[model samples]
Target: MRLTVTFFTSMLSKVVNQINISADLNCGFELACQWRNNTAGEDSGDFLITSNVRVANHFNIIPSRNNSDELFAYTHGPFDGMQKATLISNTISCQLGGGTLTFWYYRTGDSATLEVCVRQPPGSLNTADLRCFPVFPKNYAHQWLFNAVEFPPLTQPFEVVFLV
Candidate 1:
């Protein structure tokens, strides 16, 4: 018996920016993953960051207290009730530079608002300095969304926060 193999060539192209994060632990992390958010303020995505496990048949973000740093995600019922999942690394600070804010999201509830913002520390999240964008719910599959905000270079250290 003889087995023959056929060779075919295909090309895939994508554009990506490189971001380097440095922490006190003397370790750094690469910023990856597409960014998206709530269009109507009440929708979310459920995928394990490590295992890469996603809830295919239903929609729900399970609460995890296991990891000290986790992503806090919430989803509505039948889809799984709204519960807070540990969104790793809540307090993230970055060197202020003019860039865009991006994320991955899943919307599985009725029309609602998704809130994303850049906040200042030692102040109320609702204050004027907060930059908030509203995303609408139209799909349930994993989707990536992004918003470009003109940010001036930072002269001092500040915190970057995202809320859904």
Candidate 2:
């Protein structure tokens, strides 16, 4: 019932149990990742990463993003496939060290903002300035765009998020 973490000897890995995205998410975009926890054992329950978001004939489908997929998705106007403030997050505990996040994204229109941020329990002094991918504008009407985000560090619990 008690958990202790030490940096010098042990490295604690966060457990991402589930990935939930809005139903209106575009087909061109999808999220995938691998998650595991000693407690979960990586056997029972959903622990592996998978892509469930879609936008109807807009994305390349294969399996993993790094694998030999079709290549990329077709160009589109914007992320109208999703709700105005669609949110994407995972069911994981973030009360410890923050880790580096890297992902692939593609945008084509203007004003369709893709935001990557962290949300913590109320009362934390963490400010808005300590955010990554605060706004990912539609860079080009081309293939998927690679992005990397580095967080300073996290002390308390927080949830990483992606908003469109």
Candidate 3:
């Protein structure tokens, strides 16, 4: 099960720039599996940050949306059962109003799942408090697909989590 995530966009005035997964600012992944940035080598890794051209050539899939260069990916392996990668974003201020979070994704293989979740206070430990949107790919996707989730207004800061 391999999942690739492209750029993330927020329809908010404060978040004007597109979030880059390659940069270490807001993105983070679990260390239990192999995770790499800017490379698609399958030697031994869980998550990967690679370019659209590189992944397209490697996985025989279409290029990312808008021909974007950077991508965040998670590759599957024999030991993938119960293994997951959690990509966490930096705190987002939602004082004005909650907005939609949109991104393009490409996935291949079976027996894997992807989820989008939001946590308030940024460091909350309670899983029950998370508002999650789960995406189950019934068929393997060969092209990029669009997804968006709308969140309600919140006075406190929150962080978005991508679990795979």
Give the top-scoring candidate (lDDT): 3
Model 3, residue 51: distance off in Å is 1.3
99: Cα error in model 2, Å: 2.7
Residue 46 displacement (Å), model 2: 20
Ranking according to lDDT, highest score first = 3, 2, 1
Minimum summed lDDT over a 10-residue window in model 3 is located at 31-40
What C-alpha lDDT do the candidate models reach, one value each? 0.33, 0.37, 0.50
lDDT of 3 by residue, 50-111 (tens): 44324434565434546644434444443264545555555665535666666666665456
Model 2 spans with C-alpha error above 4 angstroms: 1-82, 95-98, 122-132, 135-138
TM-score of each: 0.39, 0.45, 0.60
Candidate 1 per-residue lDDT, tens place, 18-62, comes to 224523211111222322222223334322233122444543332
Better by TM-score, candidate 2 or 1: 2
Q: Whole-model lDDT, candidate 2?
A: 0.37
Among all candidates shown, the one with the greatest TM-score? 3
The worst-scoring run of ten residues by lDDT in candidate 1 lies at 2-11
What stretches of model 3 exceed 4 Å from their correct place?
1-46, 52-58, 65-81, 137-139
The regions of model 1 sitting more than 4 angstroms off are: 1-96, 122-126, 137-152
Number of clashing residue pairs, candidate 2: 4
